[model samples]
Every structure is written in C-alpha cells, then in structure tokens.
Target: MQTSQQIVGQFRRKRLFIAAMVAVLVLVLTLSFRFFEEKSRIEQQSRDFANHTIARFDRMFSPLDVSANNTQALVGLRCGEVRFPLIENLASLQTVRAILLVDHGNIYCSSIYGERAISFSEAYPELAISSQRMLLTTDNYLLKGSPVLMLWTPKTLDNHSGLIQVINIELMSNYLLEPTLPWVERAVFNVGGKSLEYGNPLIEEALPSADEVSYEESSLRYPFSITLFGPPPARLALMTLPSQLPLALLLSMLTSYIVWLATANRMSMAWQISYGLTAKEFMVYCQPIINASSGNCDGIELLLRWHNARQGWIPPDVFIPLAERQNLIAPLTRFVITEMVAHLPVMPRCKSFHVAINVAASHFRDRAILDDLQTLWWPANPVPQLVVELTERDALPVVDQRVISHLHKVGVQLAIDDFGTGHSSLSYLKTLQPDVLKIDKMFTAAIGTDAINATVTDMVISLAQRLNISLVAEGVETEEQANYLRERGVDRLQGYFYARPMPLGDFPAWMDRHLAHIAA
Candidate 1:
C-alpha cells in the first residue's frame, strides 16, 4: 500500500496539472476573442473608407451631369447666341475643362476653341449610342495620352445631337483615391468598364485579388465603385497578437494561482489523517496496566500512534481529537482492533489479561460499537479478555440497555477511563455500573502536591472501593504515588513509573524482562 505522503504528493501533482490546463485554456480563449475583435475593427475601418471615397466620386460627377443637361437644350440653336453661355457654364464648374454642342451628327460649337465640325458617331462612337453616359477615356486628340472623365447628355433620341462635358479626372484622382496605409495600400476608382488608381494611369483590367482586397463599395447614384486593397483583415489582426500576449499570460497565471490557493484547506491535516488510515501508517501501541499490589502486569490499554512518511511522529493530542471531529475516529478505532487481532500472538494468551481499546461517543449510536466488536473482534476469539474504555471527553447519548447487555454477555468488560474529570461521573456510575474506573492522570499527578485534588482523588478511590469496582490509578510516576495507591487498595496502577507505551510487537520481549525484574 502507498504511504500517506505518496498519496499526498500525487494529489498535489494532479492539482497542478489541472491548474496549468486551466491557464492554457484561458490564454487560448482570450487570444481568440481578441483576434476576432481586431478583425471586426479592421473590417469596419475598411468599409468606412470605401464608402467615404465612393461618396466623394458621386459629389464630383453630380454637378457635371446637371451642367451638360442644361446645355443640351441649346444644341440646335444659333452658335453665335449660345456659344458664350457654354463658355460661362464651363468656367462656373472648376472641374469641367470644356463643353461642346453636337447638331445633327456634327460638333457645331465649342466652349474652348469656337466652332468645329467633328462627327459625333465617328469620333466617339460609344457615346453617340447612349442618351446619357459617363466614360473614363484618354483625350488623345487635344491633351494627348491624358486620362479624362466624359459625360454625354443627348439633346434628342436620334443618337446624334447632344452636349459633351469633359473633366480633368487625373487631378481629382489624387484626392479621392489616395491610399490609407497599413489598412488600405491602394484605392481604385472605376467608371463604366475602365479603372484608375491614384498617381497611376488607367488600366483595362483593374480587378483586385479577392485575398488582398479589404473592402469594395459601389455608388448607388453613379456607374462607379471604389475598391480598397491591402493585406487581409485576418493578417492585420494577427500582427496585433504580440502586444496582447503579456496581459493574457498574467491573467491566466493569476487565475491558476487563485485556484491553487483556494484548495489548500481541503487537503489539510484532516485529509492527511484519512489518507494515513488508507496507507496503514497508524501503529498500535500499548501502555501496560500493572497490578498495584502484586506489581504484575494484568492488562494493556491499546493506543494509536501515527508516523507519517513525510511528517513523522504526529502527536495523539493533535490528530486524535481531529479524527473525532472529522468523523474518522470510528474507522481509526476499527483499525486498532484489526491490528491488535493480527498481533495477538505478541500478547499474553490468558483470560485474566485484558486488552483495552478506547471508543468514541459517536460509535455508540445505532449500536455501532457493539456491531464492530461482534463483527471484527469476536470472530478472532483471542484468549485475552476485552475491555471497552470510555473517556471523560466523550458525551455518549442515551444508549439502549440491550446493546450494553449484549456486550456484557459476550465477556466484554466496560471501563470508565480518566475518571472524576467530567460532570458525568455520577451519571455514568448510575447508568453503566462500570467494572473498572481509571483515575484521571490530573488527580494522580496531584497526589501529594495539591490538597484539594488529592482529597478528590481519595474520594474517588473510596467511592470505587465501596462500589466493589476495580480502581486503576494512572500517571503513577514516583514510588510515593505508587505506595499511596497500593496502600489505598487501588486494583491497578499505570504510568511512567512502570513502562511507557510501546509498539505491540515489542510487548512480548518487554513482558519477559518485566517478569524477570519482578522475580529478581
């Protein structure tokens, strides 16, 4: 069987393992929440940027669309009368470079140069077909190779007569399509099927990779959209992970430590006593009860002593009372009975020799003590007589007389140990009619020193003698005390004066030596 210390060590290791697992679980959960939170923040940021840029593009094109529609009404009129109004319209809108009027499949008037005759269908064939259209195209004829945004508002449904407005789109691209670093590395502005990026020429295919794009937004009022592209939101969230690690580790460690501290009391001394029982660390000891007059050992009181593998030599004063409080004393008592039965060979095999074991008050409930004796002790059928000792500290309940009678019928003697120390002395005498009354060591030690206790001691001896009860004076340390007890007709004397409590295995050799000393 494993010792108590080994079991305790296993418990501590298990606790630490659980604590560490909890710490690791806490750390992982915290980081997961943080990563999702950061990803959400970056996604929102990208979305806002895309929307704001699309709004700027809508604002830029709205005024030009109104200007071209107004000028379309003057398309078939006299050029001399309406040409100056076209120049005034172009000057009013700062983004508009120029405006032109097309009349019956020909450009009839211009705001910048005067009158011209450019074919509407041949020069810009795509615009001639649509009634209202926005296009991103390069002005190769006038400002060669420079990108411009063109709006066509036709005067009639014939696809020939209309007004064309031109915007210097390259200058506007710098402000509306500027990239936001770290979040948005580049922004693209797409019109019709053509796309333009800030500080770069327009491209035929301006599609951003799905993995690299942060957010994309299309204008509701125009044929255009803005796309912001950079590293994925997931990657940005991960970049922030290093900064979040230290606090997460600290919190997880604090939680684990609190858990460890909270469980300390559960694994305290009471738990150790229980473990000690399982590990069989408790040893059975016996203090010899000498015959006061003959100086011959008549009986032995079985005592319990603990020697923990880790914490050695625990005192009875500490663990005994604790065991009773923790409801473990009964099991401990059962262990003592079992050990005594196993080591019965080491004891004197005579009916006159008694083996006394202390029983706690709780053990009397439901005739538990009687049951233990009958089940564990009576089966052994050892030669020595059995004595059940009740101490003054015990407060036994109203026991059924049948149980006591059964114990007496089985040749079990009842003794009241540590007599005259409690208020129940007279009550026990009236109820139990005990065979032996062991005087408390306090009164025995006070034999010659204190008169008041000495008188009480005398009374106890006299009372037992009158009742024909056997008297056992404990704590007899000197010849004076022994002589006094023997002179007073005390039936037995037990204390340091004879022999101290020793292990059950050593009793046989000690008895031989004691008998030899008595004979000498």
Candidate 2:
C-alpha cells in the first residue's frame, strides 16, 4: 500500500493534469467557433455580391425587350419604305451590331448590308421561323464570327415579315460584367444551357475538380444563372488561419483578463492598496477643532485622504473600512503618523496646538501600533499633544488592554469618536473612561427637527456634565446648531461652519486668512 503523502501527491498530479486538459479543450472550442464564424461571414458576403451582380444585369437588359416590341410595330407599316430610318435608328445603339428585316424566310434589308436580299434560312436556319420571339446565340451569322443575341418580333406584313435586332455579346460583357470579373477566380454565365466564362485564363483551363472546389450559384431574372468558383473550404481556412489565429488568441486573453478582474474581489483591492502606498497616493487633511467659548484654534483632527491615480480623492468612509478588513490598517496608520512627524516642524507654532489621529479598532489589538508611535514620538522634543480618536464601528477587543495602557502611559490621549452611534456606548463610556466624547454629526443634524435625536443629544450633554468629561460637537453647520451646542456647554466644535478640512500645506495660508478676517 502507498503511504498517505504519496497517495495525496498522486491525486494532486492527476487533478492538475485534468485541469490542463480542460483548459486546452476550451481553447480549441473557442478557436473553432471563431474560425467558423469568419468563414460564414465570407460566404454571406460572396452570396450578396453574386445576387447584386445578377440583379444589375437584369435591370440593364429589360429595356431591350421593350425596344423589340416597338420595332415590330414599325415593321408592319410599309416594310420596304420604313427600312432606311429603321436600320439607322438600330445602328446608332451602342450594343446593336446590325438590324435585318426578314420576310418569308428571306432578308430584304440590313443595317450593315443595306437593301441586299439573302436567304435567311441558309444564313441562320435557327432564327428562320417568324414564331421565334427571343434567342441568345453564339453562332456567327450576320456579324460574321461574333456571338450575339437575336431579338425578333413577328408581324403580318407581306406574309410574316419580322424585325430582327442583333446585339453584340462583347459590348454587353464589357459594360455589364467587366468591372466585377476579378472578384472571383472563375465565373460562368449560363443561359438556356449556353455558357460564357470570364476570369483568369490559367484558372479557367485547369479548373478544380468538384470535390476540390467551393462554388456559389445565383439565378438571374431571365432564365440565367451565374456560377462562381474559388479555392476549396479547407484551402481558404488554411490561408486565413495565420492572420486569424493571433486575433483569436488576443480576444481569448482579453476575455480571460476581464473575468479575472471582475472576480478577484479582495485581491483587486489589495493591489490598489499596495500600489497606492508605493506611489504615496495618500495625503493628510486637517480639520480645525475650535474652543467653543474662546473661538480660538485649539487643535486639528488629522483625516486620511487617498488620491488614487485613476479615481481622485477617495473618501475616508470608503477606504478606511477596506483597509481595516484587509489587515492593512496598521501600515496605513503608520503612514499617517510618519507623515505627521515629518511635517511637525513646518506646522504653525502654538504652545497649545495639538493634532489628533483617528485609529481603527483593529489597531488597538496590535501592540506593534504602540511600538511604532513610540519610535516616532521619543525623538522629538516638545512634540504637539497627540490624540488617538477611536471610532465605535468595531468593538474594542479585551486583548488591547495592554496596548491601551502603554499608550496612556506615554501621554497619548484617547477619545471616543462618533458617540451615541454604537450599540454599547454607555458600557464603553463606563469601562474605558475616555478623555473626550465627540458627538456624532447625525445627532447634531437632528437637533432641531428630530424629537428623538434632540432628546438623545440633551441626555448625552447631561451625562457628560455629570461625568465631568470634555464634550465636542461635530458637524455644527449653522448658527442655530453652534448656539445650541455652546449653550449646552459643549467644550469644542468641528464642522464645515468652522472650516472644511484642508491639506496640511494649505492650512497655514487658510489660518492666516481666517485670523485676519476675524480680527478685521
């Protein structure tokens, strides 16, 4: 018996072989379908061309039948008297070689041989009968060694006199079919078992056998048919394979890439995060947190801004949670802190100036986060007070107790962000004993309109007062909200009414303009 590892290895090899075979089969089927589709398209185009050519021939020749009828009427009135003008009119037509007036099996007048009587039955025995209406013939009779079509109409003038118009075959071939002759290798036009061919002389002499020929036939309006022959299907497929194979492979690759991109899910986001970090696409924005009574700039909250190369300025609400889920929040948080430390010297010089950073709940579970902060903080003397704002989106794990203790020991302040939004707000408040409580924007937006939200805000204020904890009202947009929060003894305020978040580079200019406006 085989060992367990050997058996497992053998199974894996079999599975891999089967998967490879399946992939090859799929590729073969895809290429086969692509080849057949191209072949079908070519066949359809050929059919349309043949049909169009036949229709054009019909339209060109339909008028000749009507001309024959009119000439028959003229023949009935004095056949010998109307002969001169009749022959002149027929000779002027480009396709008409000659017109002859035949009466009782005898030609009395002709366009080429004028007023010369000849035996019509001996010269052309087939057209001797006055009953024969239309005939396409190749025999050399009146034109002498040229193919022509004879259009004869009979009338009862001096015992069955008839008008015969002889049409030149070469003229018809040149005008009607010459332009499109090169489209096919060989083409044969057949009318009443008589055939005229137009194509390459070499191809016509050595025509392919029936088994080796790919031919298409189209019927004309006047008892005629056009047969076109080209290279066999296998030969055509082989000739086109070189050009079409690469296109098929390229299309298959594109289809596979699109499917992979769509189904990659978290892997795609991982790639975006990796590329964004490597490219330094992330930036920091600072929103001013003001003292409610003093109206002085107390501190600023640091917010993450991602400027994707393709999609600009991804909102924190989208990317932050994604980072947390991917276990990449630690690296992202490290990037923010590192950027803040690097720009610390250029920041506005104020004794009480502080910068607060938002932290994911997952970061609390990792002790490495504290190590990273200590590495940056220990080097700078008189560093601005650092506040770590924790949100309630994810619960604080019990394992983070040691990390939280280490942070507090190092003079890092902790604040509960978006208060009253989470499920266990009161429990967290009692257990964590946080330094600041930031009222969520949802509650502040509902202060005037929503009764339940207003009461909740009032209750939060009363509780904060009793606990002696600092309270900050967020999203205070209007004077009414600002005044309401101020009256309730909210310690600090942050919102669009104060100032929207600006890049760190632009903050100093904004601060100067703001302070100047307030002073003025």
Candidate 3:
C-alpha cells in the first residue's frame, strides 16, 4: 500500500493546479475591468474639462457680440485710454505668459509676461491678418517652465472688427489629474525636440514626440496633455509620473503561476501511480466462442483486467470510460495491441485459431489509426491470428466508409462485436460487408432457457449464412449452450468451456496439455 503522503500529494497537486487556473482567470478579469474603468474615467474627465474651459471663453466673448472692433476703439483700450474689463481681467491672471490684441490688419498692444508691451505687427514680421475664424480658441504650446495654453478671442463691438485677445495661460500640470497621481510624485511632460520646459529631464523628454502624456501605476493612470494654438498639432511628445502599483501586480501574477506549476508537476507522478494502468500488472482474460461443427470452443475474446495500485482488480466497465475521458485510450489500446500481437507467433493447435479484441468504434473510423497500429505491429514479435474487432453501435456513416475501406486495403479482417443488439447493425452489415458476425451471448446462452433468444439465434445464424457472413457464438458458459450452438450451425465459438484466457506464459502449458490429450 502506498503511504497517505504519496496518495494525498497527487490529489492536492491537481486541486492546486485548478486553483492556479482560477487565479489566472481572476487576474485577467480584474485587469480587463480596471482597464475599461480607467479608460472611461480619463475620457470623461477630458470631456468635462473641455466643456468647462470652452464655456468660460464663450461667456467672455458673448458680451462683445459684434462683427468688428474699429482700430480707434482698440488703440484707445490698449494704450490705457479706455478701460475694457474683459481684456484686462484675462490678462491679469499671472499664469498668462503673453497677451496680443490685433484689429483690422494692425496691432494695438502686445505684452510678454506683462513686462515688455510692444506693437504686434512690428514685433512679428509674419503678422498678416489671417482670415481664419479666430474667435475664442484655447490651445497649448511649449514654453520654459511648463506648457502654455493660448486662448484667442476676437473682441467685437457693434458689427465692426475688434481686437483679438491672445490670452496665454501656463498649462496647469495638475488640474483634473492630481487625484490619480502619487503624493510625492508629480506628472511631467516629455519634450522630444518639441521643446516643453519642465523641471526634470525625464519629464522634458519622456515621450519621443507626442502631444499627450499618461503615466500608469498598476491599474491607475494620470494624464497630462498639451494643445497647440491652432488645429491640434499632428506631432506629439510624452512623459510620465513616478509610481509602483503596476510593478506589484505584474510580479504577483508571475509568482502565482510559477509556484502552482512547480507544485502541480511534482504531484502528477503520484497521481498516476494511485490510479495507474500498467500492461504488466493487467490480467488477460478470454471468453470462448463455440464451434459450429464440433460444438466445442472455437476462439477466445481477449479482455484486459487492470489491478489498480489503490483499488484491486478495477473492472474494464469502470475504467475504460475513465481512460477514454482522460485521453488514455490510445496508449491503452496500443498496449493491448502489442500484447495480442505477441500472441500471433504462438497459438493453440485448435482446428481453427483466432483471437478477438474489442475496440471502440472511434478507432474503426480512424484511417490513420490502422496505420499507427501497423507501425507498432511490424517490429514487435508477431502474434497468432488476429481479428480487428469493433462494436456495431458507435460506428457512424462517414467514419464507417473510411474505416471499412482502409481496413480492406490493409488486408485486416473486421468483425462486428455484439452483433444483433444495435437496431442499425443489419443496415451497417449490408454496406460494410465485414468478414465475421459475432452473435451476442444473450442469443447463444439463452437458447431453450430463454425462448426469445432461441428463435433470435436461429434467425441470426440463417441471416449470416444468407449474407455469406461467418457466424461465431460469444459468451458460451456451458456444455448445453455449446451443443445448442453447434446444432444451429454456429461456425466458431468461445466461452468458459474453452480454456479461459491463461497468462501468456501459462497459455503454452495449457495448449500442450490439450495437444497431449488429442494425441493420446
């Protein structure tokens, strides 16, 4: 008996793997949701900020309400001759880097940091009056300390051209984004040749060349943006803020997977042992098919018996399904095929000798399946006469055609195991034209004992003869059943009456005893 540590370790490993898978799923879902939420929040904040800023500019220009501001009025206001509250109020904000007033192809006043007031036309040579709609425009441009936003509004008075106020605002680094950034860490802009002045080098050159900057820590992000005075400048630059949450989440996911994988790997070997299937540890048993003429045993149907390391003598009925579900059927069938092939070189000296192996219908439909078996068969020491047996039920139409055609081409004989039970067998037999028809033991064993079985057996045998299909009786348990099948012209037979499947080593001795008896 295996120790509890050996037994329980395997189970624990499997569960832990399941737990790990669950954790990965959770991590993915969590990140996806957080990403969606963060993206949505950033967009919403941008919308709200744009709406508020634009509304303030719109209110200032509403009072002007005119198509033009005459040069006299503009010059009077700029030269301290007349007081215009709208222009003065906007210019007074210290964050404003410069203010320019333009009217009717001429400049009125230009102030840079409110220190040097000059004429706009004289200061800039390219100062031709632009026909472009330049009423209340807000945008960002790079400057020394930070990005500066310039808002342009054409102040109009009574349908005449008025001065255009260029209100330059130093872009606030932390406006709507301060809540998302760290306490000590500040958001900075990267100026890849676009030239934005921030205190740190990283912020000055973080992004190669993009207009917006967003820095992330874990699932959270802080956004910093720059707007050009005109249409959003196509070229861009970026930068980031310092944070640690992103690193933590990534490390946690990696550590969780590695630990789970290592533990799961160590546990799998024990699990296989606890529920293991070994060819050597299996018993090869046979059921007899009785002969039509002599009424004695004709052949043995080879069945595998697995003795589990934990549970003794696990039945095929219980484990075959498990094997298929676990994708172990291919390996298991290969084992059985190898063992049976070894039987080919050695068989009893019976008048007729053949061994039947039950196969899942899935194999019959697999063309490559027979080819795979051929590869295994050619090298191994040969076995006695072999019958490639398949169940009548699982074979589907398309699979049936491919399997039957392939089987015939390979010169391998096919027999439908447990024949007459499936309603579709008669039709399948007509098309497939297999070499042998196996009578279900129900019909053979129930003769005279079960009235319906006797009639069914006689009809099935007659049908087999009519179709030129060889008939064999399976699951024959008694001398009476053997005699009954022989009377009814059952061609081959197997049951407990014939020697049950002895071990491969024991089989030779059993055959020698029978030969000795026949010789005597």
Candidate 4:
C-alpha cells in the first residue's frame, strides 16, 4: 500500500512536470511560427506592391499601337499627345501610385499627377524603361522593395524611346509589418533560408531556388544588432527593428504564471483526495503517541480532520488557511472536539487512558467552548481527561491563557502541539504558558547529527522543567531521534517509526501487534 502511494505521488509529479514543459514547448512553437510568418508577410507585401504597381503601369504604356484605321480626331494632336485616357483611368485604383506614358521620350505628354516626373538620371539608371511587361528599378528600393521583375523593350522612336517604367510601392516598414514589441531591439526572420531584416539591416537575401521551402528555427538568441545588409548602390531605405521585445517576454511570463496557478489548484484538489480533508467534510484518524523509551503505550491523540468527500482530502496546508480566512476555524474546532468526545467512551481505552486532541485558537477565544466542555464533563463519571493540545501557530497569547485557564478550571490537561514551530513560541511561553510542549517534527529531524540542536533541545527541556512542563517529541521517524529525545529527558514521543495514525476500531489490533513486537 505504501509503495502504491509512493508511485502515485511520483506519477503526479512527473505529469505536472510534463505539462509544464509542454506549455513552455507550445509557447516556443508559437514564437517560432510568428517569427517566420512576420518575415514571409513582409516578403509577400513586397511582391504584392511590385505586382500591383507593375500591372497598372503595363496597361498604360502598351495600349495596342494607337488602333487601326483611326480618324484624325482619334489621333488628334498626334503621337506625343495621343488620347491615352486609359493611362489616366487606372490612377483611380487606391493601390496605384501613378501612371506615365513615355511616347518618343522627353517626358512626352505625361498624365502622372502623384509621381513627380524625374529625369532618367535622377531615377535609378534604367528605372524609367518599361519593357516586355516587366518593371526594373536601376537601383532596387535597394533598401526596401525586393526587385520583382526586370525586363527590357526595344525603342520604336528616338532609338531610346522604348518605355521603361519601374514599379515600387511603399516600404515594408511604412506598410505591413508591426514590431513584436517596443523593446524588441532586433528581429531577424530567416524563412525559406532567406534572411529578412526589419528595423535593422536592410535588404532581404534571396533564397537558393528550392522546390519546397519551409523555415525551421535553429536558435533565438537575444541582445544583438539587426543591421540590414548595408551599403547599397543607392542608400536611404533602411531602418532598425522596433525596439520592443517586452511584449513577447511579457506574454511568456503570463503563460508561466497561469500554468503555475492551474497546477497549484489541481494539486490542492489531489491532496484533498489523499488526506480526505476539505471545507465541509470531517474525518478522524487516531494514532498512538508511544513513549518508546519506556514502552509503546503512552496514549492516543484524537486527530480531528476536515475532508471534502467530493474533492478528496484537503491538505491541512491548503484548506486550513482557507478555513481560517473564512472565520470557520472556531466552528470546525468545536465540531471536531464535540464529535470526538461524544465517541470517546466507545474507543479502546477512553475510561482508563488520556486522549490528546488538537484545537484551533479560534475555539479557544470562544467562551462557549469552555461551557460546552463543562457540559460534556457533566455526563460521564470521569469525563475523559483529554490532553488538549493547542497548536502554537494559532494560539494567540491574549486568548491562549483564557482558554488554557478554562481548560485547567474544567479539569482538562493542556499540551502545546508543535511547540517550537510557531513564530511567537518563545514569546508566548511567558504569557500563554501551555502545559505540555509537543516538540516540532523539524527539531527532531537532525537530532542525531547536530550537537547545537542537542544543546537547543536541552535548553528547551530545561525551560519546560523550570516551568514544570512536560515535553513530547513529535515525528520520531527513526529510533535514533527517539533515543536522543529520551536521553534528553523528553517525557513522550510519537512517530511513523512506531505506528501511523489509525481508525479507533483498529486500536485493539494495533495494541495486539505492539504486544507481539514486544514479545519478539
């Protein structure tokens, strides 16, 4: 049974780890895709601009050689002044920048409103030539638009009169791509094995021709320069990537936090199953607090618990705090004590022995608890002299004394459960002064290995002795701890090394088992 529990616990840990890893992995995958997608989108935008610009320009310059058998009116004002209304018509398209008709050169009868006509020298070398349905800039947006198609047309007039129209839309920076963040100093997307630089190095490196191209992320290192491939024939079209990586990093942080919260909630539920403690459910598992130094027959501690039957055992660590926050601690403690005392006489040796119990300080503050105890004591002749163990954590000094005084007045003994673990144990000692000090499990954890701990133990024992108090060592998991505590004059001890908590019905069987061990 123990092995099975250990296996289940291991599985839970592994599963949580895997889930956390998967969450991180999924985020990484998304980041990888985003990085490349940004690059592709930029490239696609460049191509779209090139294509759109070139298409409209194509119809304007090549208008079927002035029609066949046309009248003087149709060709009115001759070649340079031909009625190429179609050229001006395409300009209405929002995406179209402008249209220019270069008949017999010399910026001959142009209709380009937006694009201020510049000499061939001012525009890149052959950027003015429109040839064979293709557009070529003498110098690429050398910094921006990727060169789409470059072609040449033979001139029919002025020897150099062939139309040369270069197509170029807005730059990627001014158009499509949005920076991932304000702090992203650099973003270099390598998709299709072709590098794209935004807000950094200008010019995308074209890919080696491949049938199918897909980009796989190799590494994503930080804190580096994102300079575009520098120094072009014609400069001025380069800008750095928007410095905004905080947005992406913030997203990662949020993802991690969400995962942490979810896992914590799930584990809280799982622990409820294992321990059977929750807000609404009640459970009890009596365990013997054996004095191993003398014999395995000291007494039993009636551990009252809250279990959420549907959700499982709420871990005391989780639900107890919630109960306290909700102000349910007092009622919970009262209910446990009342129920346990009612069932006391039926347990193994309720008439003959002492049974210690834990009570939250919330109950200690309520005077009703004292009255109730008196009523419970009235019925049974001896009225079970319960060793009321008050947890140090919740035992406030102001009320602890009031409660302890009441318990003493009612003839019930008091024990300080988890003695040295509370933040105010030493301070509270002078005021609240509980009867028995149940040593915290942690002090005994390293008893055999440390001398200072032994000295500390001795000092605590001395303090208890001075106060005429008794010491009960808790969590004596090893014989060594029990021996050490016994040697140091600890009056009682409890641990799994002796026995785990059990149901009251199993008391007789446990005693019988101990007897058999004693005999052996």
Question: Of the candidates shown, which would achieve the greatest lDDT relative to the real structure?
Answer: 1
Query: Tens digit of lDDT per residue, candidate 2, span 1-520?
Result: 3333443354445445554455455567677776686667656655776687688767756776667666765653454677777766775576777777776667777766667567876766555643444465664556454556676656654334677888765566545444332234655555544555663211122344564453546554465666666655445555667776677566656655554444454234555677789899988888988889988778889888888775565677767776777788888888888878777877766657778889888887768778777676557653578888999998887788777777778787788999999878998787777888999999999979999999999999899989988898999898899999999899999999999998877777777877787788
Q: Where does candidate 1 stray beyond 4 Å?
A: 1-270, 309-311
Better of 1 and 3 by lDDT: 1
lDDT of 1 by residue, 1-520 (tens): 4444555576687668878888898899888889999999998988999888878878888888887777777889877888899888888998878787888999888787778888877777778864437778897667888888877877777877888888888888887888887888888877776888877875555656766864678999977778778888899999999999998899899988887877665555677888898898999999999998788999999999999776777788667777877788899999999999998887889999999999877777789888888789989879999998887687666755556667788778989988998778998898887889999999999988999999999999999999999998989999999998899899999999999999998899999999999999
Which structure among the candidates has the greatest TM-score?
1
Query: What are the RMSDs of all candidates, in order?
Result: 11.2, 17.7, 18.5, 15.3
TM for every model, in the order presented, reads: 0.57, 0.55, 0.46, 0.45
Per-candidate clashes, comma-separated: 0, 0, 31, 38
Tens digits of per-residue lDDT, candidate 3, 1-520, equal 4444444565576657666776666566555555555555554554444444334444433433231233234443544433344346444454444445555434555443322244544433222333223322223322443344333344444212334444232243333222222211233321112223233322233342342433322111111233212111111100111132365357556766766766664345333532454436655665545455754445667787777654465566556654554456566677777776666556664435666777776655456457656787656634444677777656455645777777777666778888988768887787778889988878877877888878888888999988888987877778898787787777887766776756654665666665576567
RMSD of 3: 18.5
Better of 1 and 3 by TM-score: 1
TM-score of 3: 0.46
Q: In model 3, what is the error at residue 400, expressed in angstroms? A: 4.3
Model 2 CA lDDT for position 223: 59
What is the Å distance of residue 178 in model 2 from its true position? 35
Q: Which run of 10 residues does model 3 get worst, by summed lDDT?
A: 230-239
